[model samples]
Target: MTAIYRSAAGAAAVRDRYDTLLDRWPVPSGRRTVRTRLGATFAVVSGPVDAPPVVALQGSGGTAAHWLPDIATLAGRLRVYAVDAPGEPGRTAEARPPLTSPAYAEWLDDVLDALELPRAAFLGTSLGGWWALDHALRRPARVTALALVNPAGIGRRRIAPLLKFAGYRLFGAWGRRRSLAMVAKGSPADPGRRAVGEFTFATFEHFKPRLEAIPVVPVERLRTLAMPTQAHFGAHDVLLDQRDAAAKLREAVPHADVRLAEDAGHFLPGWAGSVVTFLEGERS
Candidate 1:
């Protein structure tokens, strides 16, 4: 396990560098606003209003900034709205409710109402993917399409390997950095890797506390989803077993199309072109 510098100065430096990079390569031109609801102000990042809408939900401890890499690639064809999940960091006002699947679905509906987007395609990664799936099940008519990138909440309950658990406990910060590094290496888009990694890492840092409060999804509820779903998992993902996650999703959404990215990891959307092609082809 690598040691993370615990000093205030070190943390500050890390934060400053992260902010600088975010400012330089901001998510393609969009509107930013806070929607006050349930004692929280959820931050909303919206692209062109005239285009077909696609809402992006970032993973646990991840922010809207993580989707910037795929923004331009997706925005050309659709209006992209990246939402900062409440209770997590990065622009959203924090008033965290108990992190349950149903609660998340309700909150997402509120966000859509605030944005005035009656129906839109939903794209998500990891924990965000879990919420998106649950949201689709709860409001099938509101979601036109579903795209999940290495989504969580699909596997059975079991403790992670001892060594991996120990590493996460002892070197949580360093482990996050290493994971971001791996994401950068696995990403197919070269120019966006470093920028996206920095953004994702910073988001992880900011949302660490809130993330711990959320529980994994229950396996029994997986069968409820009925959307035209497209899920992608990295063959070599370190967090959740790719094969297990994919299998569970297949069992849940029997008709959904599932694909595997041979060399990718949890950060599947960094391989934007493939994802875009899959969405376009599947929709067509």
Candidate 2:
């Protein structure tokens, strides 16, 4: 089959950068490859063998390296399995499946089964969050707890100014960096984050990532998710109306714990600690 990357050289460069990122990880980890019918999924596993498991899903155009900050904290007390979401700009197979189907749920289940884990807490950000919810709605028995960080599809996603995206496509890295800065939380002063951002921009220049309009689950469906669930939103995420998302989640899923981080953006605040608390503690 033809490759999804714009060019083999571009894919090689991204992987080389990703290799360097693996060296700077906060904790020790091992890479595991899980083969599925759709594709071969890749994951970086860390932490204690006997600890409760937490499956992490990366945002769009994101790789496992993006979770470096969270891994140190979450892995201290729990096993962290960060997957390279297939079809995104990662090492996973470049097989893009329709988002509006049960494929993601099935794929996620396959991942869990491959890991020999029947149930585990889930942590997802942006597009990853949507996948977690999608799987929970389809197979609630597999997800022990859920955390959505600045997720999409909860409310109507706000479209960024077309001109902003246009500029990135037109002017290359400079414009791409500008667009990323608009929603990113902190400056890329950290070498790890800087490297990740570079790959994200290079992805934009090469591959055309599949864009899907994540549909909001019906309020009835939202209420049916009986597992312990929480959602974190950025107070000022330009990518979505977080205020609206918080309000709707409160109304539809009264049992949910929803929090808005002040002055935060779509990149999300360093709230891995909060997610750990939610997963480890009983829901009120």
Candidate 3:
């Protein structure tokens, strides 16, 4: 099951929280642009030009801001381009059409083309991870490396009922607080909880469209991807059973490196030092 955030009031609260967080930990220095194509607008945040390039994609209903925590750690090592998914909210604003997996691949390709990046490492979480892997398969030459954190869509495992539970239809101030508490349960670190809450609430406000638009890539297709890939999944992921998902991923992308975080959940990237180490190791 997918949760879509779409109440006007709820959106505002989320926006406020995101803005506040950005204010506190501003991007060191970079360029921000609004790229438009196919009637969709994408907000692109680019860091140092000479650094190794990486494009970060967030999960379903999430925006580019979902990467802020990692961005702080990765920007210096790579020219990170975090894109506000066209269909989700944040800087991107457009009436998105119903998108299939292929359409999503094309959209990401367009974003890369617009940025004039010949090749880049792709990092994604949950739905974003699925998209990253799909993109790699669609244009193997364009991807240098791929990293997925507690990603979704690798198998048929069901998400835990608690993680799927949202107290309100749309998260307002109270909903945000409650949602944060739920997210905190999966995250081991305090900073991780704060970052997850901010990102989740923002997603709740801006993204619109049916959850089904995010396609589940079958195991057969995954086996064909040739990019250098590393996937991390929490042992206790509430959204998807890691053991089954990891096994399927291994069968499909036999060459891909997979890591299991024993104490984490679906929100593994927010775990600070651990994720930083993972990214650093993969980059090396």
Candidate 4:
């Protein structure tokens, strides 16, 4: 846990806060700590046991609990296994395998093997989307479908907004909030969005995010993706070039559905409905 947190005490506080969130999970669920090569991989399993399985991966600073906003809708149609990705602020191992290495694919394979799932669809956001895309490219047979939101690896990261964000961090709390506003698209008055923002703010207070650069997927490799695929990008995204992401995806995977939300940023709060629809469409 110290690998992801600043200190032992910080890890404990983050875990406690995360556990409290599980009790409030929108649907009936059970926690599963699958022993993987990386370490004990924690996942929250919800929805009908007989339903089609979907592996859900959170972003860089998120936990399985971060699925709180989307779980109910997704779980209603598909069995959702929301994982606390290793090295993130969750009850998973602190071992952050190198993003450039094949380790993440192997770790995900171990997760599916331990879960006894022969194959499953994937729902990944941000860095999680990178994991899903990488695995799909590496082991396409094991992945049934793919749904990515503001995924990394397909677009180049924009420099200007990032530099501005770094400059904003110099202002302290107010600066941090300003930084967050530039990332997630939501009104401060909306209770649901505000709640998620509050949780994210609190989590980062104790968690340390990854500093390593995310690798971009090669165009030739992306062209090999054969599964049903969809990607969402935010026009106002400060981190990655969303227009380039959408354009590249369209060029590489002609059949893939790519959307650019003009009002959204890096964090898309109300994206569950469209994602669920896309996932369900593949089944039908």
Candidate 5:
């Protein structure tokens, strides 16, 4: 299969930066490598052995380490497994599955089977949220619960202004930063803000994400998620309207809990505790 990266050198450079940030991971962690039809999948596990498994997915151009705050927060409470999504800028396979089919769900099933976990909770951000919802709809029995942060796929994808593909491909770093500036809107005092900026910029500059437009799943399809589900969105999200996404989700899944974070943008203010509490309700 053809690698998704724009260039081998770019991929290697991004990986070097990814490894550098990962080396600074504050928590104790273990790495797991699983083989699936999609390709080799990688997940970073943290937290206690006795706790229930909670698989997490990050957004576009994001790696498992991007969920560092969530992993740290859920350390002792739940065993967190952050999957480095295949086809993205991570340690996972460069082969991207078609977004139009059940390929993602099947790939996830393979990962879970390889890990010997039958049913575990799920938490996803942006594109990850879309994948989580996809899995829940396709393999409902495998997902114990669902949580999303500024997730896409629930509504029509909004067009991003001033962030053109040509710009990213031609100008590189500057264009990536221009795009990142729209979402890396954390509090200025955030000590990790600089690192996040640097990482995202590098990801955009190096990783070649699938250009396929992620289609909106049918409402009837979304209605099949029977597990406890919560979806969170940033009020000021530049990509999608949180209120619109919330209304659509509530209409599709009447029992789903939806929230709009007042201070959050697309990147979101970390709400790991809120997600953990919701998942715990399903367990306890």
Candidate 6:
């Protein structure tokens, strides 16, 4: 059995917690299990049946449940598919594909194929942003639009945040919470956000995360994305060089809409409205 948790019990605990959050999903939603070459992928589907489709990807070590706060607003306009990527702490396969290859884009191709979507927009955060960007670069024809939040693979990687996180780990649970709070700045103070935060803490308590270097998307390739693209960066983010990332993206794709939030960090909360507006505009 493929698992990202330290033990089977840990996996069950995470799943149970995730399920509980889904039970409180502010809007009507359903689960989707799509077969792909990488493995069986899972997505929490929301929105109207006839609405424009958008596939959402979460950050590393996160699941679809993390998107609960945004679903109600997002599903109000377009069809939303919050996908749990392979190798992450979700129901997806535990196949850790190499970051340097085209495997991820191909896996996404299979997902789109199974979903029967000829074209769709994409919403991704951090590692998920990198995956969506990779797919857009590899298959520009299929992506209608792009929405990235504190995405990786744009600027040079820094070691300070990783080292700081390591130091926090030495102090045990208290330190871990500090690490999460420090890294995930600007999380909204809402009930759904709180539930997600609790679930995140529980997940990291027993889950093992990927340690490989996140691959950077070459700046030149950014020009190939003819589709509408909007990227949001948090100025306080410690995990990535958000300023440099935003600069490079603006330089490469001059037409791209990029925003840098001075008060936000890597985890952007309370910004779902802007994302929904962007995606909804694309449909018209």
> TM-scores across all candidates?
0.78, 0.93, 0.81, 0.93, 0.93, 0.95
Task: Highest lDDT: give the candidate number.
Answer: 6
- Model 3 alpha-carbon miss at residue 122, Å: 0.6
Clashing pairs in model 4, backbone N/Cα/C closer than 3 A: none
True-structure Cα RMSD, model 4: 2.1
- Where does the lowest 10-residue lDDT sum fall in candidate 5? 184-193
TM-score of 1: 0.78
Q: Over 4 Å off in model 6, which ranges?
A: 1-3
lDDT of 3 by residue, 8-107 (tens): 6766766676566556444565446645454444554545677767788887667666776666677655677877676565555543545453666777
Tens digit of per-residue lDDT, candidate 2, span 1-284: 54667887877777777777777888888999998767999999998987778899988878888888668888887788999998886778877778987888888988999999989888898889889888888888888988999887787677764347766678776787777777675433466556666667666666656666677777787878888888999877877788888888888888889998877888775688888878877321
Collision count for each candidate, in order: 0, 0, 0, 0, 0, 0
Query: In order, what is each prediction's RMSD in angstroms?
Result: 5.0, 2.2, 3.9, 2.1, 2.0, 1.7
Return the candidate ranking by lDDT, descending: 6, 4, 2, 5, 3, 1
| Regions more than 4 Å wrong, model 4 | 160-172, 186-189
Model 4 lDDT tens row, 5-46:
777898888788778777888789998999988899999999
The TM-score that candidate 4 achieves is 0.93
Q: What lDDT would candidate 3 get against the real structure?
A: 0.66
Task: Judge candidate 6 at residue 262 and give its lDDT.
Answer: 90
lDDT score, candidate 4, position 12 = 89
Clashing residue pairs, backbone N/CA/C < 3 A, model 3? none
TM-score-wise, the better of 3 and 6 is 6
- Go through the candidates in order and give each one's C-alpha lDDT: 0.65, 0.80, 0.66, 0.84, 0.80, 0.86
